[model samples]
Target: MRKLLVTLVLILTGTAAYLWFEPEDNPDALQTDQELLPDYVAENITRTLYNEEGYRADSVTAVRLEHFELLGFTQFEQPVYTLFNEAFQPSWKASSKYAIWFPQDKIILEQQVVIESLLQNELVERIETDTLEMLFPDNRLQNNQPVYIQGKGFYIEGIGLQADLTEKTLQLVQHQKTVYRNED
Candidate 1:
C-alpha cells in the first residue's frame, strides 16, 4: 500500500512539472509582428459610393472582404466594381480575382482583371489584363502588364495600357497586334 501511494505521488509530480514547463502551443503566438491582421472581415459585401450630386457614382461587390483600417487598405476576394456616368448610368464594370483598395482613391486589381464597357456606343468594349491600377473620381486606369482590348470591330493586344474612362481614350504603350473585322 505504501509503494502504491509513492508511485501515484511520483506520477502526479511528474505530470505537474511537465505541464508547468511545457512550451505554449498557442496559434496567435506564431503570428509575426509584420503580419497585419484585418480589423474587420465580411462576406458577400456590397458597398456603394455617391457623387456630390447625390447620384450613384460607383458600387463594389466582393465575395470576401478584409479591412485593415490602421493600414488604410482593404483586401477583397472576387471583387466587382461598377462605375456610373454623370447620368447615373453604369458605364463600366471591372472585375478581378483579388483587389486591394487604398484610401487615396486608388485600387490595385490582380489576377485575371477584366474591364467591360456598359455603353453600347463605346468604341472599347472590353479590356483584359493580369494586373491593373485604377484611380477613381478621375476614372483613370494604368497597367504595366500585358493588356488585351476588344472594340466594336477591332481587337488589340499590347504590353502596357493607359485609359481614361471619362474621356473615352485608350492608349497602349507597346502595341503588339491589331485585328479588325468587318461584319458586312
Candidate 2:
C-alpha cells in the first residue's frame, strides 16, 4: 500500500510540473485569432450638423446607419439619407423632423417627414409617411405608408412602393389621389 501511494503521488506531481512549466508549448499557441462579424445594423437614428457640402449641393436630412462593422482596424459606418432632393445646390439648407435606423437585415421608418428642394426658380417637395422599410446590401426600400409628392406640375399620393435609391427610381401605387394647381 505504501509503494502504491508513493507511485501515485509521483505521477500526480510530475503531471502538475509538466503542465505548469512546459515551455508553454508554442508561444503562438496561446494567441487567439479574431474574426469580424458578418454584418451589423442600427435603428431609430438621427444625425445633425451645421451643414453638409457636396460638389453641387449642401443639404441636410434624416440619416440612418445600417449594416456596419467595427472590428480589426476598420470602421464601418453607412449613412442613409432620406429627405427631399438629395441633389441640391451648395446653398441648400433645411431641418429634419424625423428619422430612423435599421439593421442590415431590417429597417423601418414611420412618422411625419418632409423634404423640400429649392432650385433656380422653383421648389420641389416630397412628403413621405413615417413608415418605411429598407433591406441592406441590396438597398431595397419599401414604403407601404401613404406618400405625397409634389413637383412643378405633378402631385401624387398613394401607397405600396418599391424604391431603389441607388438607382434613383421610385415605383409607387397611387390610391384615391388628386393633382391640381399649386397655389404656392
The numbered model that scores best in TM-score is: 1
Q: Give lDDT tens digits, candidate 2, residues 17-89.
A: 9899877445444332213332544444554433255332222233333332433221213333433334433
lDDT of 2: 0.49
Compared with the true structure, all predictions reach lDDT values of 0.93, 0.49
Q: Estimate TM-scores for all models.
A: 0.81, 0.41
- Candidate 1, residues 73-157, lDDT tens digits: the string is 9999999999998789999999999999999999999999999999888889999999999998899999889999998899989
Clash pairs, candidate 2, are 43-101, 44-101, 109-130, 109-131, 109-132, 110-130, 110-131, 111-130
Query: What clash pairs does model 1 have?
Result: none
The global Cα lDDT (0 to 1) of model 1 is: 0.93
Q: At residue 147, give the lDDT of candidate 1.
A: 95
Clashes of 2: 8
Please identify model 2 stretches exceeding 4 Å from their true place: 1-100, 115-124, 135-140, 182-184
